[model samples]
Target chain A: MPQPLRYLQIFATFARNSLIRDMTFRANFLIEFISSLSWVFMNLGFYILIFHYTPSLGRDTGWGKYEFFVFTGTALMINSLAGMLFMTNADNFGELIRRGGLDFVLVKPVDTQFLVSLQRVDWSSSGNFLVGLGLAVYSLRCLGVWPSPVTIVLYVFYLLCGVVILYSLMFLLAATAVWLGRNETLFDFWFYIVSFGRYPMEIYEGRFGRPFRWFFTFIIPVLVAINVPSRFLVQSIRPQSLEEWLLPLYTIAATVIVFAVCRAVFQLALHSYRSASS
Target chain B: MAAIEIRGLSKTYRVTRKKEGLVATLRALFRPEYEYVHAVRSIDLTIESGEFVAFLGPNGAGKTTTLKLLSGIITPTSGEARVLGHIPWRRENAYRRRFALVMGQKNQLWWDLPAAESFHLHQQIYGIPPDQFTRVRDELTEMLGVRQLLHRPVRELSLGERMKMELVAALLHSPQVLFLDEPTIGLDVVAQYTIQQFLREYQARTGTTVILTSHYMKDVVVLCRRVVVIFDGQIIYDGSLTNLVDHLGDYKIITIRFSDGQVPTDLSRFGKIILREPPRVRLRVARNEATEVIRAVLARYIAEDVSVEDPPLEELIAALFASARNSRLSQERGNSAVPEDTTHSANH
Candidate 1:
């Protein structure tokens, strides 16, 4: 069989096995699914309350209640997809290091990165993804300006790019477990970093926020992950500046660079892995 | 070509040196003293294909570390090794595909899922054909008597059952080289014997090069013909298992069962009386004198049964480790004047 086909087959098997594993603990799975959905719903409620008093999220930013909702929906989908695919696996990386479960992974014929990154899928996160999709469609209908076919395709492509960026970031943090022994603090860092991506990049444009905007945009590239994809779906927003026009290309470039860097770091970390003594 | 070849392969780890007590803990929290641990040091070894070699050593003797290095689970700090003409530390897919490593303590299978699910995942990962995968999986499960347990959640299975499933997972790829690290670490005698029998049969049929590190002497004795004893991160002895006895075991144990409580008096005249029950007595005699001692005992007492056996491999190995430690201690004492290097090196 061809290599790519074999990897796809492996990933399919992994997804199926993860579903089986999740189904084995039926009540826990349901509770997790409900818990994730409740979080998304509560966040949406908070936004709804805020929108009641304001015409737009920011002054002269053209992000109306529904527009910002679209952005929020994009963020939700991207985060949910990332959570579904890599969250559990990345969270378990430290445990794998501590318990030496990685030794078997390293010995497999499959790519170590592929095996470690996609071994387990958090199916519960799919609930949040469906909710995010509902919010996006509802917001689009409320706005009464549906995106073109080309725009939708571009939006989906950029949404996938966003997911990849998030995966790469989480993976890079997880890879540190090899050196740090226990990197439970990485989730704290992740929450802090991903929080910035939840809001519009325009909100971080003042004196204090400019530096953060610049840092997250160019250095970490988290801001552009959701911002550019949201721009594609929110038809009212048009790219007027050269930087804005290049944002989509920049997100694509960042996704590729960040993913490549993460893969390289993961491999380097594997070289350093001392696999807890048997 | 040899299945495995290593030249001066060494692995040194920089581990934190923690002192006890509040002051020391605080000092360590700030200053953090570290020391180097030579896990595997300056060792060279070669094993041909289809050879079942047992790596015997006490804890921290680098047996598992050596296996990890050979299987590409970890890189060596210095030197080089090639398993099947590929540098193991390079971790090429081709090299990885042809080799398998089974650790008894770790579960590669998903805990909540059945062993069959994990087996299917392995088939996809290794790209084993459907027919070949089924054949191999069925054959392994049958031989290990785990066919019924395949559908049970791995967490629900007993340790022995889980270990059998782990073996099946490791062997699904039909690897040409197998590395087993303490594969019978926590198992009952029956389970251990079953695995030992399976491994013996599998290695015979597959012609796979097998390197196993096991503390269980029974595993080593039953499954391996060649034994390599490691001590202090060094290869202390490497030869056939039988020769290991002939070379280090100087004594033989003789057991005589006297007829109807007619036990001999003054048994010390014959040899060192190890066991002195009423009708049955066991004596430890020099290997050269074992036959004469047994003959004399038999002639003197109406022996219903007589048996002569070499000293247990466990005792011989323990003695080997003690002697090696003593020599190492003396060598360290002789070199006490040398300055110790406290500088921490980069962990590999």
Candidate 2:
């Protein structure tokens, strides 16, 4: 039908084929799925132990047990989206370049970036995503905060924004593999950067924290990713100032800018690509 | 119009050089040495549409590099090329849809998925209509005799069966031009013959321009009429295969079997003696002198059997490269005569 619809259809086919491939190694898939979910549960347990002694993350920062759990859930959701969609492909991008697998990708009639970024679907990562959703609903219920449908819709919108930001950052890191030849440290670096978003932004409010907060909030924008969406759910609990209400707009703008810049970087890397000799 | 054209096309890569040993490896991590490798030098050529041409070369002889440049897999270091009226490196979708590059050592199909699944993916990627996809896929699989293997995972198939499936995947789009880089490599004689027969029939039916790079001489002799030989990143010869044999192969091989009890004392006047057995002798005679040499041998000896034939293409090609190397060495030495020792080294 239409071009965009055709691409979506192709993406669906890729997802279907990936699932079939995964089914071929069903035992390994189950192991990975269980391991991923275990990590989510372990994190939840660690935070529950912390909430045992502290009333809030910061004395006056309004981050109580349920509020912080909401933030944790939002971070997990964003990370899982990225992990499912781009992690496997990005991790394999270096090998593809090194072993000349990208030559086949470059010759395809579809968009190179689109195909490379979305070719593999990690269905196992969705386990963490479902767990994250459950935590978010559980925390919302614990807070006795029944969000309106509009608030829930806004939460989903901002959750997508968070995923887009994470994807752009991960993609940009993966694109560097073209020049670096091999970047095995990319996942380590990605986890380090994303760990900052796992907690409430209020944790970074002191002397050294001020600049860290400002840098992540404005430059990398990871702080805003989970903060805005988690805050959208508890808007009544912590009423928003004008600037707080404008966070969604800022998230949109950041997503557009980061997406465009990363896309350009990826294209420039592809232009400089000297394929491995056969 | 020519389906493919190239002038001064080249590719140079900056290769990192590292020394052996742990200390040097550690030092290289801080500061690595670099050298420029000219994979393909200035080369000029053109091929008409629907022409099947063989690109023959030894290892590291720039055959694959030229194909990558023409297929838009990699950009050139300098110069220009146009395929089907479009610069290949520009990589417009329309251009890509009309051409296919199949590398024997690399695969596009997913390892865990069935070949049929990959075919469907190609149909989507190329935006092929369902009917056209099915017809082309069935025709190719049927021709290659691989219809039964399409539903099995690609990893489980043998190399020859996998290669046939790869060909089917590449050709399902009905590309107007096909670039095959060593398609029949590492295959048994029967498998190679099967691929060759299918290629010949496919070329005849569709008139697609095919440029194949193969180490197998039989693939070239059976499928392509024209051949381009490359050495040291340059085009050394380009003409019909028959012309290649005529131009470089100037001698014929003559084998003579004498009656059991008879032996010729001297046959030097007839030709250069290549082999000598008690009752049989082989000689390399100049093409023009072959008839006269045979006449003289028959007159001088009682022959039970006699056979005269052109040397195999493999020998002709080895001789061509050895001679080319010899000339290059002589030119480097600033002499008109090749050293006798160097000739032995070249032959080996």
Candidate 3:
């Protein structure tokens, strides 16, 4: 079989198995879905309260209440999809290292990164994904914007780029657990970094915010992930600057670079894994 | 060609050292101490295809480390090893597909899903053809008597049942070489025997080269004709299991049943009194002195029956380990018989 076909087959099996596993614990699975949806709702409610006081998120940022909603929805979709696919696997990578579970993975005739990253899907995050999709469409409708077919295509493609970026970043962090031995702080650091991507890059324009924006935009590329994709979908808004217009291309470049770097680091870490003795 | 050929293969781990007490903890937080542990000292070994070899050692003697190195789970600090014509640490996909490693303490199957689900996942991961996968899976499940438990969640199965499933998963790929690290750890006697029987029969049928590291002497005795005894990361003895006994077994057991149901009063004069019941007494006599001791015992008392036999394999192995420790200790100290204080465990 071709390599891609083989991997796709394995991934399909993994997804099916994960769904079965989730259904096996119906109560816990339902509770997780409810919990994720509740968190999204509360976040949306918080933004709604903020919009009531101010017409836009920031002064002259062009991100009106509904426009900002689009950005938030894009972020939600990106995070939800990434979390559903890679969150549990990345979080468990550390435990795998500590418990020597990775030994089995190393012996399998498959790409270690692919196996480690996509082995388990968090089905609960599907609820959050739906909520994000609803919010994006509802906000687009409220803004009275109908994007062109090209814009919609670009938006979907960039959303995938956004997901890949987050997966790469999370995988990079989890791979560090191999050397650190125990990286319980991985999610803590990830949460902090991802929080920067939640809001629009416009909010970061002041003396202190400029460098933060530059760091997150060009260096980490988290800002461009959701911002560019959401910008493409919100037809009423147009790129205000050359840099903003080129953000989509930059996001694509960043995804490729980040994923390649993650693969390299994960391989290096695997070489250093001292499998725990039985 | 040799299924495995290891030359001076070694693995050294750099471990952090922390002292006890709050002050030491604080000090370590600032300036941590570190030391190197030689998990596998430079050792050379070779095994041909279809050979079943047992790596016997106390805990931390580098048996599992060697297995991991062979399976390509971890790279060695130094030296070289090739499994099936591939350098293991290179981790080529072709090499990985041709071998499997199973650790009894760690599970590869999904905990929340049925074993059948994991088996199907394995079929996809290994890219096994549908017909071949079904045939192999059925054969393994039927042989292990786990066909009924395939649909049950793995967590719901007993330890023995779970281990049987693990074997099926490992064998589904039809690996040319199998590495088993304490595959029967933490199991009842019945379970252990069942697994041992399955492995023996499977090896016989498939002719796959297998290297197993097990603390259970029974596992070693029952499955392996070739045994390698390692101590302190070095191979101390390697040969047939029968030869291991012949080389280190210095004592025999003598059992004497008295005509009257009365215990011998001075049995120690002959040899170590291993057992002393009212009617029968067992003695551990030097192998060379068995004849004289038996003659002395028969003349000294009215015996109903007498028998002689080799000591249990466990005792011989324990004595071998004890003698090796003594010799090492004696060499370590300026004295001729300085023994290191490190613990040596024979879990069996």
Candidate 4:
């Protein structure tokens, strides 16, 4: 079916107005804004404390230890963008289905899936992205080097991949509403997984942690979005050969497959929805 | 030729069977028993093109279920049906684009935006050409008399106004078929009449095939000529509305008016007395017996006038269902698990 352009315009208008309405609750907005800033400060505070205790990467590793710590933290900051932006949609879709708000979408001419998943944007996430960028730039200055123009461009591409992996996995989880009904525990467990993508995969030094980061970096592909960019900007973090960049290459293919599967599962859920009886 | 063909169509829903309580819920979570409720049983029906058919039934009598099947909202458990030469449940976009379903209990209009936004949305969803979209949208608005309501938020409109706007949204694409489930429900008489009038004119102008289910007999009386009466998921009556009235020999009310405001002192000897006001009311009489009964009343009592009326449509429907219930009782009483009428409809 052709996209409903005017309807989408109206939908965006509604979403914008709703966001503005939330901003009107001055106390709540103030609370959330402060809490989110504090959250970023807390994550970095823990990192600086850890660096104070170990000075170098296991005392025998090659790169500047502080540079390594800050860069790995940059990966965490970029990955948080997924939480900051797309997570809201993934979280809301399952509830929307259970609540019959999905009926509102189905009666419309638009593809119900598109409306449900992208219906709202968390404009507040602009705060998380800015703070994260500032941290990355500060970490670069600590190394006394400027990232090449190519490195900056590669960072943006990786960020886009990060969003896709997040979107596809969330869509996959929300699609479970079709069979099991709404299960929010599955969605919360996803946020817990994002925490693992915070550091360099090498931190734990054991096979277990290696496979864990590898699962997220390749199988799920979220870690790649973060690790690839942070690895590039910090320079000594990534493998130096063209062949070692294969993981990021694998990410694009996996992103496509995840998206196709999400689309299929979401459509199946729509078909099975039994609307309320009169 | 038939525009719709339903052959041995049956639909059933599985309802979990368990006692009501948290304990039962937990127990059932592990080992649940389910009972099947046959919402619509195996039944064959055919509807020809350009026909306005009123589907009538008591609550849970499967009228809306049948309409849902015809509209492709739910797939049947068995058998097959076709609308406009397409299978509905497959939900091919082209087949979906050809028909519209208007449910009275739900609104397709966006609640916060002006109704026009939804119309434009339909324009894109159906891929309607620009010129045709404008022409049809304007024509529907004018016909439904909602030209002034285009700019108002749907939530602000009165029930009648909202319903008119809903009709405009449903018809913005000018579908060839319309399936309406209780389109006149919960509306004031004026609003109902306005909708009924608009529907009649729309059908007359476009010759669109309309299948509507309404509890209000007045709606069916004004809109549909042929009535399909379903009871217990079976099409017990299908033919002209007038014919069903005649063939369903149930009850007819007869009343007599006398110059002196007094009923005949003895009504029991004449017939069953239903109303006891000054002018007497008696139970309905069959055609053959009504003539003899009327003569006896005339000979024995003095009256200024007399009138015969068919029982209210609602009452007639209730009587049909009551009879169905009694038959089921008898079958259970006799413990007859044997199916009835297997020999009928030998062709299919």
Choose the strongest candidate by DockQ.
3
Over 4 Å off, model 4: A1-112, A120-154, A198-200, A218-221, A229-244, B21-24, B279-283, B289-305, B329-348
Candidate 1: C-alpha RMSD after superposition: 2.4
Q: Report the number of backbone clashes for model 2.
A: 0
For candidate 3, lDDT tens digit of each residue in B1-348? 999999998888877786899999999888987767888889999999999999988888899899989988889988999999999988899998899888899898999889999999899888999999999999999999999999999999999999999999999999999999999999999999999999999999999999998989899988999999988788999999999988877888999999988877898988999888869899998999999999998898899999999888888878878887888665555442334432221110
Candidate number with the higher DockQ (1 or 3)? 3
Q: CAPRI verdict on model 1?
A: high
lDDT of 3: 0.89
Q: Clashes in model 3: which pairs?
A: B329-B338, B329-B339, B330-B337, B330-B338
RMSD per prediction, one decimal?
Answer: 2.4, 4.1, 3.4, 5.0
Q: How accurate locally is residue B122 in candidate 2, as Cα lDDT from 0 to 100?
A: 96
Residue-level error in angstroms, candidate 1, position B152: 1.8
Task: Write down the lDDT that model 4 would get.
Answer: 0.73
Quote model 2's TM-score for chain B. Answer: 0.91
lDDT tens digits, residue span B190-307, model 4: 9999899999999998999999999999999899999988877788888888887776655567877866777777766656677777765555665666667778888877878888
Model 4 chain A scores worst on lDDT over the 10 consecutive residues at A101-110
| Model 1 DockQ (Cα-based) | 0.85
Give residue A83's error in model 3 in angstroms: 1.1
Which candidate should be chosen as best, given TM-score against the real structure? 1
DockQ of each: 0.85, 0.79, 0.88, 0.27
Give the per-residue lDDT of model 3 (tens digit) for A1-278. Answer: 99999999899999999999899889999999998899889988988998889998767778998888888889999999999999999999999899989989988889898999999999999988888888889999998888889888989999999898888888889999988888878656887888899888888988999999999988887887788888887633656788876777788889999999989999899988988767
Better of 3 and 4 by lDDT: 3
Q: Output the better candidate (3/4) by TM-score.
A: 3
User: Residue B344: error of model 1 in Å?
Assistant: 15
Q: How well does each candidate reproduce the native contacts, as fnat?
A: 0.91, 0.71, 0.91, 0.13
